[model samples]
Target chain A: MANGIIEKVKEQATSVWEKVHGSQVAESILRPGSPFKKGYSDTPRNRSYVIMNNVLYHLHPVKVKRHGVRLSYTLCLGGISFFLFILLTITGIFLMFYYAPTAEAAYSDVAALSTSVAFGSLVRNMHRWGAHFMVLSVFLHMSRVFYHGAYKPPREFNWVVGVILLLLTLLLSFTGYLLPWDQLALWAVTVGTNMAGFVPVFGGQVKFLLLGSVEVTADTILRWYVLHVLFFPFIIVIFMAVHFWRVRKDGGISGPL
Target chain B: MSDIPEHLLRRSAEAKAKALGIPVEDVLAEMTGEAAPTPMDIGEQPKVETVVAPDPATPAAVPVAEPETPSQEPTPPAPVMAASSADAGDVDYDAAATKAGMPASLLKRSVEAKAKASGASPASVLAEMLGEEVPAAPPAASAPPPAEPAPVEEITESVAEVVEIPIVEPAAAASVAAEPPAASRSGGATAVAARPLAQPEAVPEGVRTQRLLTVVKANAIQQVKSEPTDKVNTWPHLMIMEFAALLAVTAVLIVLSVILQAPLLESANFNATPNPSKAPWYFLGLQELLSYFDPQIAGVTVPTIIGLVGFMAIPYVDRNPSTKPSDRKFAIFMYTFFMMGAATLTIFGVLFRGPGFNFTYPWADGIFFDDLKDWVNF
Candidate 1:
């Protein structure tokens, strides 16, 4: 009697799943080539459709050169850098929810994250470390491209775009460093921006613009906060789009060499 | 014609436009009968007929319409054998036949059969079979007296002369065939009968002579210079590896996050400044340079000129196209030198500099960098 009930339940469960998967709503949500779509099969053409039909996978081509897929060739440094940026963005958004950007509340809010908020400390840690990792990975990716002579010929423009992206990565990291509103964050930024005051003619003006004052203060924190979270990310995303596009346009990854 | 959907007609027009190198709107206009058919439109009928009916006699009849090129009008009677010898010099008939996926003997026999039926020289018949221009027909006056077989050697020898025939203008051929003189001048009764097939009037209105779909030449729309590469699909092959890399990075980041809490020191105090205040690690190298040179040079010039402008210029400056390490030794060496120099400066700034920005080994002075202060306790 128990076995028969279990079998009946099993059949009911299967039918329910089939109904849900094959429903009009599900079909509309899952595009023709989506792996999550009902009746998807593992075929070579379907494999191509998997990339071609999906929005996120649209970043990559339907196929890539065999050698380009090997971990050793690229060391996956560029992909890691991009992935780290995404990780940082996620963690940064979580950090933003509990913390305020003003100098008066910034430190206390950050302190409260560890003491009061759930998983706040962990997310903050991830954000901090992920930013640092992104900078390192971007620099390493640039080095790898250089060593392989991937910046040659048709790839020259892409290399320039990549260099701009690296600079943006550093800018993004630097801006976020000042947001913690601690002694370390304050002094570190002071030392860094003080260097900007040494520029030839517009040194003082540049430093003034960056800080929103003659020196780092409450206004400077808010200014850097907006830059770190919104402005720089928006700019970086645009450049990254061009960078990935140019990679495919300039003939995918460079070569076996 | 009216029953076809607008989109289907538009699509067919697009294919015809692309093949004929005309504007799609023009083709569409012609297809809709909104614009009168040009001479070019009438010209396609015979080519369509050739494709539809591969009968041997049809091709022989087809070329008789070529009064458009007066140079092809002179047909010398019984010059079939003589013209064969002159025209068949350059092309290797056997090699061409093999490449076309037929035996040399089979191609010759077919040519012989076509020549006999059409009363054209065997060389011209061979040219037609190979999709090449048939050599100028021997004079209509010399049309080979019924079924006289030409020698094989003469036929194969005369392919060279066919190269001199100007590309046939189908429009001109269609118009020329409409005249009685040209139709009568065709070599045989079969040729005269085939002339009407090329006439635009004979085709039923709205009958699709060509299919709407065609394989558009890849080069026509985009530059496809690349050779077939050894490739794998991006789904399981590349995406799987990408996912693995992503998971590995996530795992490492999560572990690091759990083990080491991010640094959040005492709130900012304007009065008390740390002894050896430093920039974030990435800017450390520039700060390190601040100690050695004037702030203008290290802080302003170096970062902007060498860091930004100079790095961006590397590709444009290094004209060495070869990606091989052996071939570009100097480029590789220069980049390696810069990398090593930057690493040395950054390392010096991060670990070696202590209180008062003075040189002090981390082992002796205890580490001064506050970012890593929690993780690296001396």
Candidate 2:
């Protein structure tokens, strides 16, 4: 009886919807077709459906055959790296709230974040270590994917994205270096950015822009700060989206050997 | 019709329509056509007209309209199952069929075939054989089907339509989930199902235990992903990417530390300052221009503007993978070399050696700013 009432209500609601929005909505709601196909659950929509439906689902293979080393393969290293990147982003933002880019007090801000604020030291260390770990994991992820032949065929562009991400990781580190504004920070940035001076035609201009004029000073520190904290991160995120989208488009990672 | 059960007989006309995969009216129209030819042969197209019911005083008459539905050729049903049944079951079939190599159809066929071959009714054979244990076997499922041939088509179609759990060919996309350093292949569908599946891998005695251990072992392993092997192209391969990276990072720290020993002093306290009070080496390029423009403009304003633009533009300039270092080696190399030279020149001018004022080597300093007037502009 309840089902009958609900069915009647559904019929009425459908007609009402059709009246308001036309029959397309009604047709779509009642289409007789399967939403998915075989061998292609790696599509972005399906992946998210799986992830949101079952969080641990991504951790396991679609088919689990009993092999000698099945467990080792099921928990991917890339997933770990992706998780750590998330950790770093969170901690980095927290640290940012306390850090100032000016040479006058950037060092003290770090020192205070380490010793003064509540759990500040832990947050800073975690951010610092998270950065380190993410770099390591991402590197390991690339190697694992390569050895497994995952970078073949459809996954090629994602490899390129990974490489770009690697560069961005290094850049993030380099930009953060100057936030401390100590002699060590200044010289380190100087040496790092100096590598840019090798460009053929626009080398000098690139150098001037990075240094803010001719050298590492307050301007350079501020530049590195914004780039590290804001610019590079924003860019890296966009690239990451494309990378993941490509992974889905390319039919997921290469399967077993 | 009299022998059929009431529920079976009452199978709704709606159910019949659904099962036949045709509209109720269409079936009626077809039956009518066969029973008595229509004056117009019902024309080609069946026009789908919506029925608008008026008040109870008058009933709307049902009428069949003709409309041309595109002709769809009958396609054979694919032999396959839904990837994972979100439908129903508590099937012990897999366990029963494991040793038998049997498909389900064959299980249904066994008694029938045995009865026919032995000249006994299938029910009579089952009644007499009830007490004897017929080990649930799979091979028997396939044995009886070949001679009949009809079931082969059914199995073939099911095989095509079966929705596999692993959407990607299992062998094709397994590594996506392989926790780095270990490739645990728990065949069948998942680790959860592998417990039962592992029983067969034990044909080699301890093989089952080992497979279980491998699947269990992946839990504890430290899965470090983002391996840099393929990225060896970005960095020189000779250093062994990781080692080179480690070395490069260490070199960077060392080089920076060495350069910091003689950091340029801030111009804010320059009166009693040492001979060269330049900005940091990283700031040298800007300091070189301070010699020309006012401190407010060259020292603060210009650098500020450039820094804002540089950072803000990064996402726009290198938004995609096509601009990666591996794809644009020369561009990366140039980016590196040019930035480095400029940094060095700027540092050298501000702290150690300048075009004017102080007299020190940029590396060791006595350097101070010299005017274009005080020294050669070039």
Instruction: Kindly report the fnat of each predicted structure, to 2 decimals.
Output: 0.92, 0.00
**Runs in model 1 with CA error above 4 Å?**
B1-223
TM-score of 1: 0.68
Q: Taking the tens digit of each residue's C-alpha lDDT, what string does model 1 give over A1-257? A: 99999999999999999999999999999888888999999999889889888895648999999999999999899999999989998888888898789988999999998999998888889998998899999999999999899999899999999999999999999999999899999999999999999989899999999999999999999999999999999999999999999999899999988
TM per model?
A: 0.68, 0.36
lDDT string for model 1 (B261-309, tens) is 8898899988889989999999999999999999999999999999999
Best candidate, TM-score-wise? 1
Candidate 2, B1-378: lDDT as tens digits: 244344433444346557666566554444334332122111122121111111111112212122222211111111112112212233233443443456656644774675566554444433223212233321112111111112222222222122223213222222221211112122221121111222232345433221111112222344534221111111112113324444444454335333322222222221233333343333556656556676556655555454334423333454334423366565455445745665675655655554333436644533354211122222
Off by over 4 Å in 2: A1-71, B1-378
Interface RMSD for each candidate model? 0.7, 13.6
Candidate number with greatest lDDT: 1
Worst 10 residues of 2 chain B by lDDT: B71-80
